[model samples]
Target: MENTKGISRARFLAGAAAVGLTGAVLPAGQAAATGRGHGHRGLKHRGVVYTVGAGETPGTAWSAARMRGDVRVIRDDLHADTIDVTGDGVERLTATAAEAAERGLHVWLQPTLGDVPEREILDGIAECGRFAELLRRQGASVDFSVGCEFWLFVPGIIPGATVLERVDNLRKGNVDMARMQRRLARFTAKAADVGRSVFHGRLSYAAAQDEEFEPVDWNLFDVVGIDYYSFFPQPADYVCELRRHLRWGKPLAITEFGTCAYVGAPETAGMGWDIVDYTKEPNEIKGDPVRSERTQAAYLVELLEVFESMGLYAAMAFEFVTADAPHRPDNPRYDLDLASYGITKAIKDRPDDPSSNWHWEPKEAFHAVARRYGRRAGPGGVTMAEEVRAWTGPLS
Candidate 1:
C-alpha cells in the first residue's frame, strides 16, 4: 500500500532552480504600501494549492506534500480534479485537513462549484461550509472559496453546453466579460455572507488574473487573491498590472502562479496546459523541441523577483505535484512533464501499475522555491514604513 503520510515518489516537478535569479526585476512603481495591508492579523499566506486529483482516489499527492512541511499554508483543492462534491469528496477533504493539521499547516479549502442553476448556487457554499467546519473543529486553520473560474467551470454562467465549449468561448472572445464580472461580484458577495455563518477564518476566491476584478467588493473578504500568471509579452508592464490590486489595500495574494517544467515553457509562458494535446493519456503526450527545464527555472527566478520586490501579502506556487502526468525518456510521446505545473514530477510507470513508483522525485523547481521561502522565513513580513503600507479602505 502507498503510504499516505510518507514520501514514496522520487519525481520532482519542472524548472525551479535559482538560475539567473537577477534577470528581470520590475519596479512596482505605484505608491508604496503604508503598512501591512489587510491580510490576516497574524498569518502571512505562504502556501501551495495542493490538488487531490482522481487516480485511484484523491489526497495521495497532497498527503505527500503535507509531510514535506516546507509550505506554511495548504490550499487543498477538491474541485479541479473531481467531478462532484459527493460524500467521497467530503471524506477526501477531511483527510487533507487531517494531514494539514498533523503537520501544523493552515488550510485553504477550495471546492469547485459547477454550473448549477442560479437558484441552486448556494448549494456550493453549503458544501464548502461543511468541510470548513470539519477542518476547523479538527484544529486546522481553514479558508474557503465558493468556487474556481465560475464563468468557465460552471455551465450556463458562460454560453456553453460543456466546459470545453466554454473555454473555447473564452478563447474566441465570444463571452460577455462585463456581464460575467457582474455575476462574479454578486456571487462572491453571496458566497462570503453564507461562508461566514459556518467557517471562521479568511475567505477569498481563486480568480484568474484575466478576469475583471474591479467590480469585486474587496471589503467582503479578508484578502484579494489572483491566479496571477506572467506571460512572455509582459514583464515591465506586468508590475504595472499587479499594482492594480495594490489599490485594494487588502493583502493581495498571488493565489496561483507557476511555470511548467518544459525547456521553452517560459518562452511560451502561461500555456503549459495547452502545450501538450490532452487527447492522449498524460504519459502518451508528445514532447516538443522548445522544451527546456532551464527556461522554466528562469521564469521562477523572474516571478519570484517581481513578487519579493513588490512585497505583496503572500505567494503560493501553482501546485506540489500532478498525478498521471509522468516522465518517460525513451518514448518522448509519453513525456507529460512538458505540460505539468507541478513542483515535483511523477515517475513514469506502466499504466496498469501506477503504484510501481508510489512516490515522486523532486524537480529543479522544488529547490528554487524552498530556497526562496527559506529566505523569506528569515525577515518575515514586509516593513510597514519602507516597502509596504498599511491596510486602507478599498479602492473608490
Candidate 2:
C-alpha cells in the first residue's frame, strides 16, 4: 500500500510537504571515525533493516524460530554488525531484539505503527521503550527509534487518517505547511520525552529531508537518523547533501537506504517498488519490469561506498527480506521479488519443491554486501564488539 514514484521516500515527502513547509551524526573528538576519511574506512554500524511482522495479517506473521534463522543469516552470512529490528507491537520488537542480541548484533528497535491515533502511537512507543530497556538490562546492545516518518504515519500532521491519505493530501497540496511543521516538532519533542522516560539507551527518529519545514530538533536524539535514498538523476556528491546533519554534533546514521531489484530501479531508488500493484491480495508487476539482481547489488555497493567516504556512525540498508514478495521465477510477471528491496529473495515454502523448502535464497546484493561488510572485519576496521561499544556508549 506504500507508493512513492521516482524520488526516494524522503524526497517524495519533501516534495509533498513543499505545499506545507520542510526537515545528525557523530560524537566529537571521534572526528577521524566520521567525515570524509581514508578509502572505505567503514562505518561502526554496517547494518540492514530486519522487519518483524506485527502478526496483524497472515502475510505479516512469522515464527520466532524463523526470525532467529534470519538473524543468523544477517550476521554469519551477510557479515553485518548491526540489525535494525523494525516493526509494530512492543512484544514483536522485543522478540526480534532478543534474537539479534543473542547473535551479538546491535539491535535498533524501531516500532513502525501507521494510521494509529496520537495517544495510541505514544503508548506504543513507550511500550517499545520498556521492552528495549529489558533487552538492554539483559546485556543486549540496543537503541530505540521513537518513530519513523512521523509526517506520513502520525495523524494530525498532514490531515489524513491513513498514510496513503496523508501522502495524497501532500500530493494534492491541501495542507497547512506551517501548521503541520509546528505539530510535527511538538509531537517529536513529546515522543522523545516519552521514549527517554523508559528507554535508557540511544534514541533516534527516522527523519526525512523536508523541502520547506525546518529540521527536527536533534537536541532530542543521541544520533541523527536519516532515511536517505538517492535522488534519481543521482547527485554528484552524496556527502554534500548529507553533510548538513553533522552540524548538530550528533553521530550520523543512515537509518534506511537502498533500491529495488529491477532494471532502472537505481534511478528510482525507494520508489522502484511502485511498479507493484498493491491494490490486490497478490501484488503483481504492473508492466514488464525486468528483474536484475545485479543492478540492485551495484546500487547498494555504490551507496555503501558513499556512506564509507562520509564516515557515518551506521548505514542500514532499507531491508533484508520481504516475505510477502516471494520470488516466482516460473512466472516472471508475477514475481514480486522484482519490486522488493530485500537483498535476499524469499521463496514461498512448497512441499513438492525441495528447493523452495529452504525458505529463501540470496540475491547478488547479499554477496555484494557481504564483501563490503567483510572488509570491515579486517585489520584496523570496526569489529562487532567495537560497533556495539560505540553504539551503546555510556547511556546518560
Best by TM-score: 2
Q: Pick the candidate with the highest lDDT.
A: 2
Regions of model 2 farther than 4 Å from truth: 1-40, 55-60, 211-214, 231-236, 280-282, 350-358, 377-396
RMSD in Å for candidate 1, one decimal? 10.2
Question: Each candidate: what lDDT?
Answer: 0.53, 0.73
Which digits, one per residue and each the tens of the lDDT, describe model 2 over residues 22-54? 211212322233463223455878999987663
Using all chains and alpha carbons, the TM-scores for the candidates as numbered come to 0.72, 0.83
lDDT of 2 at 396: 15
Residue 193 shift from truth in candidate 2, angstroms = 0.3
Root-mean-square deviation of every model: 10.2, 8.0
